[model samples]
Target: MDRVIIAGGGWSGCAAAVQAKKEGADVTLLERTDMLLGTGLVGGIMRNNGRFTAAEEMIAMGGGELFQVIEENLKHKHISFPGHEHGDLYDIGKISGAVFRFLKEMGIHIYTKSRVLHAQMKDRRMINVTDAEGNCYSGDGFVDATGTAGPMNNCSKYGNGCAMCILRCPSFGGRVSLTSLAGVQEKMGRRPGGAVGSMSGSCKLYKESLSLEIQERLGRDGVAVVPVPPELVEDHLEKKSCQQYALPEFRENLVLLDTGHGKLMTPYFPLEKLQKIPGFENARYEDPYAGGKGNSMRYFAMAPRDNTLNVEGVDNLYCAGEKSGLLVGHTEAIVTGVLAGHNCVRRIQGKQQIILPDTLAIGDIISYVKQEMDTPEGMERKYTFSGSFYFQRMKEKGLYTTDTALIQKRVEEAGFSRYFSHSGKKDCVS
Candidate 1:
């Protein structure tokens, strides 16, 4: 069996490992931190707006294992909040562990605290990677899921000093790109006004710190929208990576979702000001311990790659997630990871790598992001199936639908239903 190594065990890397294992490849996933699911440690929103369609499409294509696991861990489902609808909020506290166990069961070797700091390559093909602790891993083909988030310096230089978001760069020694190690010229995306990077769109507030009514409402309905006084409203929308949520509603209100915490739908709110709001007198941040200032910065080290996710200038290297472009959201990352994983195996087999046709949302997005990333304006923006430029485009193209049957049928017609599913030897089911 061909050994497929995946760097950065975020949602993308985990998904890549799953697809690779499903294709009967020996898989190894490396995560910089002690845990898996990078930003997903605090990010729990799923299937919001067009994300529902994209997710269903993924399920139809037989790449929905992680999505299924997430749904199983959801605290609330079929919810509506702000600009998002029919959303599901998972138990962020349990998701990483759940994903870890699933990947382990799938027979993918996962290494935490294994940050890839260097790569050995022959010509354009990568041979292996060395981690921060001097541990080396070899592979037949590699997937650069090392997301374009932070190494702390980017956060300090671009946004506010590390609000200490989930990436935990301070301890993990920051994200070192596998593509960069492989000597590929990577790209950097911009904020709205052509700034270097974008701030994380939201933060997490400890659920216990919120007022009883807000906590009760959130725990019950999975969301609580409290109107923010105009005087306290902050206008940092332009700095947000999640442009989809950069709306007047978000600015005018404190939108909190129950993601095993109060998911504050803003980049950062002044802690003093947040305390002044009703039902938030004890408000406090959870993930970015310094949410009053700013959150972690992202889109810093995007690798230049084709729609099929093959890293340009490298023969056996592929990329997904933020490393692939300015594509944001876990759904986008997982889908791209799935494609990259499947295709890398094909590359090792000396077969033509497959590309999802534009007929499907997954295919269109993979192709669309690469095309859009070529332009200046596109670089200054983010893309996701849930919202922003891409969702609108999905609507305009008549590709947005909540009907799961239609999505499944579409995948079948595209000749890719259960495309990633393969019966392979089982190592352990426990």
Candidate 2:
């Protein structure tokens, strides 16, 4: 029996474990936290990426047939709230819960509150891992779906900064990070349709350092800012232990603050100092995740891009979902998880490799990450807008996938085209 060990039980970790088990590998998942707090670890930021739409035309004409197929399998419905406009929000927690249920149904061993301390590597191959409780576990192949690339971090700390690359600049284009708050009023009053007020207030600011200034200006209009910062933005973060905080999850009719900036933007400075900023005062503490402080960063929270998934030094170990570090949203995470899962199984069986949809941006994303690590010389690294720069590299490789085209198409279809314009000179996916 092939034994496989997985670290972290968040979306990515759970997805990976399920996939590995399906492939006939005995999978063990280690989650540092005891219970699954679907509640917002930091102000329910996970609940609101808003609605990200891909172009239906592209999805149809392109090789992205799987995109449509998987999306159709997902459940979506219009939810109404008092004093707010009701729109379709994908029940992401449900999707994650489904995976967890599937894992349990399969009889996989799930270890909660067991923190994997370190991996014992022999000849650069991971042989065993030690947890916080002094329990030593070994496996045939280890799936490091640890959001912050936990195993890779241990390896890099002892070895050279191998298996990962941390971009220092806070202003990565594709990524953004911001805090949000709830407890606001509906301005438009109640309408017959559902609610007259908007469900969420969008944050216009882009920079991490200017987050407070931007929030102050926006919050004055009844908008709240959730305080979720990237670890790189905080100075004391690297030195001090992680500060855990309890956060409230949104249920029916829950008002949430804007987290557009804090969750997506990469932090320029150390993220620890940002918590000490003026706005985050009186923020209470909650449960901590397995990977600690760095993993909690908004950018990392979106999705991780550790070199584990990339075709590099290691051969047997395969990564997927948020742990892949390239995926940002739930749909992408699940899709990639499926792809990685299917492909890893096929590869083990010595069958043909599963080729990703080249037409879709997601496909290009995985390929681009592989290319980024290939040269290692003067990689034009910049966080333009979340992971947009990576997509831009894919463009250079002849892939014309952009969130703008897809998002704009949806906006136009929804009769809100004017709200988004290319002429504004401010690129959403810059």
Candidate 3:
């Protein structure tokens, strides 16, 4: 039997190991911590796999079929807003535990409280990993799913650093979502009354890039959601961290919030600052999580042109999930892990595994960040202290708006609008 090793048992690692086992390969999973919960997911980010059915399909085909999947996973119920609905507050621990349980049943070996200190390599391939205790583990193929730890730090050809934080509601109970609020008025025939804030319902916060500035400009353009200026930009810019997590708990009707900051990188509501804001004075942290800063990584986005999992110049090695240049959310992490694990097995078997297409949102996100976006030249041009560098780039490149109409405009600008249409309707609550 071929041997495959995976680091980190988070969503991507779990998925990869399960998939590899299903492919009939022997597997070992190493986790620095004892559990599979991700900090970024505390108060779980909106689970996006396209529409409801796509989400259902992910639950179904991702190792276990849908109903069984639901029974094993955490099922969340969204709340009814005045004109919209917010996704349910999923229990991150419960869901990850279920996934871990399935992986275990599939005959995968799991090592807890073990940290990969370094990867032993030869001729551009990783051969083994040395744990913190000085124990060495070797395998025929390896999966680097160590959140941002294994891949970004250990394998990237170019070293990297990034940071994320979580913002909470200023009041005791408040709601937040990454749901896109762009062009929401046209769909409902009337705009939602009052101010619109932080829709996408799920928004991805970058590392103090021009995207932040674009969000500010978009606010000036009368868009509802706006990016709050960083409370401590200099501090955040000086150092970097990455992490993932289970969702934070919330009070009745109050949605737990996060942003790309602090411990976990989830939706933020800005509780402390809410007290300073004129409209909010009663904000508070919903469920405060206590743990190491969080599971974070600054790693590559994808593999080489052939799409093999190997990281060049890094020997006896492979990277999976965030470490391998895969930038998807929870769903993509799991799915990519499956693929990475499968690839590891196949590499050992001297065969090829399947790959997803870039046309898919998840696929494209990974592809661009890993292979294209933020080129060295582009970085040199934009990484300046113009005070509005990030904002200007976001507008010019149209990067920050996920609004369907705005997305449509961008697609049209790229000459793909004729092939796609923006359906203003959001996913209906069942």
Candidate 4:
């Protein structure tokens, strides 16, 4: 009852492990590659738009361990970019080590290079999981945070092939879903015209390769927007997975954020064309190494789950991050991860698992994304707190706010102020 095994060590999986450990469980986290954080290695944007409200909500909810780390490591704070405001960017170069140290200090068992490829289930509950190395791991509960990116095959079929982003599919093998391995039928997201998956909306560039002016500007402002000449602008927004960044401003300019590496906000920009733009003359792709063509693909496989984050048809299986519906962004993933991990322990404890009341932003999104993901139209779009439809909805519902004290009060009003702070006798209060 005290053991939990979580597959995948991205931001969500890491958060899940943290919550499970805090719940007094012996947690074991398995990651596919040599390092952790997965796509988070290339992602550093935080607190932009409704994300500010969501982050504050989580902090007040007692799920702020990771958020604290992120804030401490942010290279730039309170910055703005095209279609986004009050954003912060973490130093990608230092984040992996910092997060790794935190997890280790918490005494969570972390096994890198442990890609879970198989699972053994008894009745409706998972008994154990086996990594690609043939090592078996058993626990009282399980979580599938293995994200929805590619394994080479899906990218080639659905995207412009693998842009070789941070997932490092070839080196460590692509992502393998624990939900699918448990004999559950998984769902795949589709594009507007019935395409299989969506292309990742961003790529990393070597900052040193940029012109002195651009580099200096990024250092000073954390964002550098250079207008793309009319002819140099290539329209790949249709293929972008991050609908949040698919604004006209993104295409009108080459928006770069300082996340250690220059984060280019586009599915992929052709190098030859990108070079034609004024300061990007010496620009180079850091990740994927072929940003000229495309980037990593996502939303290939999602697990069907309830608002409580339990995988349907499985008694002790839970999911988070991209595996949990079409929810995107680190904020979205981290919150879902906390819920799934907490619920896994609650289920094993034989307590009635709790669902966040939609009064709070985190809770609302948990239920909203699940409901939206059920329709044909909903499957075509990505949901995040940062921007686009979901963010708009947050504002309309009075769920979006940046006031820290107000967010704490809102969580208190939702009756989950410290729900994740420690094990609870009841759902709302510990």
Q: Which candidate tops lDDT?
A: 4
Model 3: per-residue Cα lDDT over 1-430, one tens digit each = 7777776666677777776777767888876655664433442433321322223323323333212443444434443221223333344446656656766776888886666666665554666676666777777777766543222222122212111222121221111100001100110000013211111112222212224443343223212222234451111211122111111211111222222211122323334543453322433332232111221222222333224444444432455554454243454465456556655666676654434344333234344444432354221111110112322333354343325554444443433332211122111211
Q: Tens digits of per-residue lDDT for model 1 on 1-430?
A: 8999999898899999999998889999999899999988889989999989989999887889999999889999999998898999999999999999999998889889888888999988999999978998989999999888887988999889988888887888888888899887888888766789899989999999998899899989999999999899898889998999999999999899999999999999999998999889998899799999999898888998887799999989999988888888999899999989988988898777788888888889889988988999888889999998999999999899998999988888888777777654321211
lDDT, candidate 1, at 152: 90
Q: lDDT of each model, Cα atoms only?
A: 0.89, 0.37, 0.40, 0.90
Instruction: Name the lDDT of candidate 1.
Output: 0.89
Per-residue lDDT of model 4, residues 1-430, tens digit only: 4899999999999999999999989999999998889889899999999999998888888889999999889999999998899999999998888999999999999999999988999999999999989999998999999999997988888878878778888899988999999888899899889888998899899999999999999999999998987877788888888999988989898899999989999989889888888888898999878789988889999999998899999999999999998888998889999999999999999888888888888888889888988899999988999998899999999988888999999888878877788845455332
Error of 2 at 67 (Å): 12
Q: Identify the runs in model 1 with alpha carbons over 4 angstroms from their true place.
A: 424-430
Tell me how far the alpha carbon of residue 326 in candidate 1 is from the true structure, in angstroms, after superposition.
Answer: 0.8
Q: What number of clashing residue pairs does each candidate have, in the order they appear?
A: 0, 52, 70, 0
Name the runs in model 2 displaced over 4 angstroms.
Answer: 36-99, 122-124, 149-311, 321-323, 347-353, 372-430
TM-scores for every candidate against the unseen true structure:
0.97, 0.46, 0.54, 0.98
RMSD of each: 3.3, 16.7, 15.4, 1.3
